[model samples]
Target: MDRIISLFSSSALLLFILVVQNTSSVYGNAEGDALYALKKQLKDPNNVLQSWDPTLVNPCTWYHVTCNNYNSVTRVELGNAGLSGQLVSQLGQLSNLQYLEMYGNNITGIIPNAIGNLTNLVSLDLYLNRLHGRIPTALGNLQKLRYLRLNNNILTGTIPFSLTTITTLQVLDVSSNRLRGYVPRNGSFAFFTPRSFANNPNLEFPPDAPVAPAPAPLSS
Candidate 1:
């Protein structure tokens, strides 16, 4: 009886291990598919994304992609790769993503609101692109965001008030865009200066304090 009980216990342990492994594999495959969808929409003139193979079970081995120990994608650094075309909404599927550095590319089109789903995101660097359209209000969902640089783009429309909710935000550069309307002075925005919104011809600057006039009548 002792021998039979020991054998049953071992079998149960093995089955548990197999279930855990299978679960990890399923999650990793989902992340890979999301990234592959992005690669399909891009114009990779330099073949930098050649290593992205959908047949693979995980994208952790792909170039410019980083994954956590659990095989979940954590970062995607494809900055200045000369990649054009619009960003894919599937990128929001990377739940573990921390840094998304795709700046300095020729990418165009409206910023996808789906990106707001990256709750773990720390830095969102999509600056220096040809992207145009309103800043997505959904970005406010990223409570962990620190560096939000969308500067040097042709983006239009008012700055989303939702952004002010990110108290963790530190470096915000939306300069050189076509953005308009009131820049929120509450919360984290109160720390930012006019330079952060500089070169936007239509954007209303924070009202400067009135200057005192000289006593010209006393001199006369």
Candidate 2:
């Protein structure tokens, strides 16, 4: 009778442990699935994304993907990997993502508004791509954004005034795009120079703004 009771207790403990493990696995798999969705849309000719296996419980082990202590994705470093194709909206599902580095690729298509959901984002580097369409005003939601580099794309339309509200912005390079309209010269824009809007022939500086003289030559 004693032996039977001990066996039953052991079995119950084992079942409890399995249940906990499975619950955590399910949460991790959701993020993994979101990344896998992006993989399907991209053309990875060099097999850079070969390690992105959906069967894995978490994407932390995947190449070019970084995760925190709790296994939540924090950074995705896949710049210049020769990837092309449209970005999927599911990328916004990475709730904990902080750094999204996908610059210097042949990626085309408009910037997805879903990206605005990444409120924790610190840097959004999509420069040197073939992306077009107006800059989404929804990006104003990223209060923590410090570096927003969307230059060298085929983007059009006026720069969203809402972008000037991000006080934490330290570096903004929207140069070389097809952006139009008057550049905001107030708030965070006050710190930027004409060079930030250079090469965008349609964009104009404030009409009454004073012209800055060329810097004096440095003493030899």
State which candidate has the highest lDDT.
1
Give the worst 10-residue stretch by lDDT in candidate 2.
205-214
lDDT of 1 by residue, 1-220 (tens): 9999999999999999999999988999999999999999999999999999999999999999999988899999999998999898999999999999999999998889999999999999999999999999999999999999999999999999899999999999999999998788888988887778989999985586222344577655
Which candidate number has the best TM-score? 1
* Residue-by-residue lDDT tens digits, candidate 2, 77-187: 989999999888898888899999999999999999989999999999999999999999989988899999999999999999889999999999999999998998888
Tell me the lDDT of candidate 2.
Answer: 0.92
Q: lDDT of each model, Cα atoms only?
A: 0.93, 0.92
Cα deviation of 23, candidate 1, in Å: 0.7
C-alpha RMSD of each candidate structure in angstroms: 5.4, 3.2
Model 2 regions more than 4 Å off: 1-23, 210-212
- Model 1 TM-score? 0.90
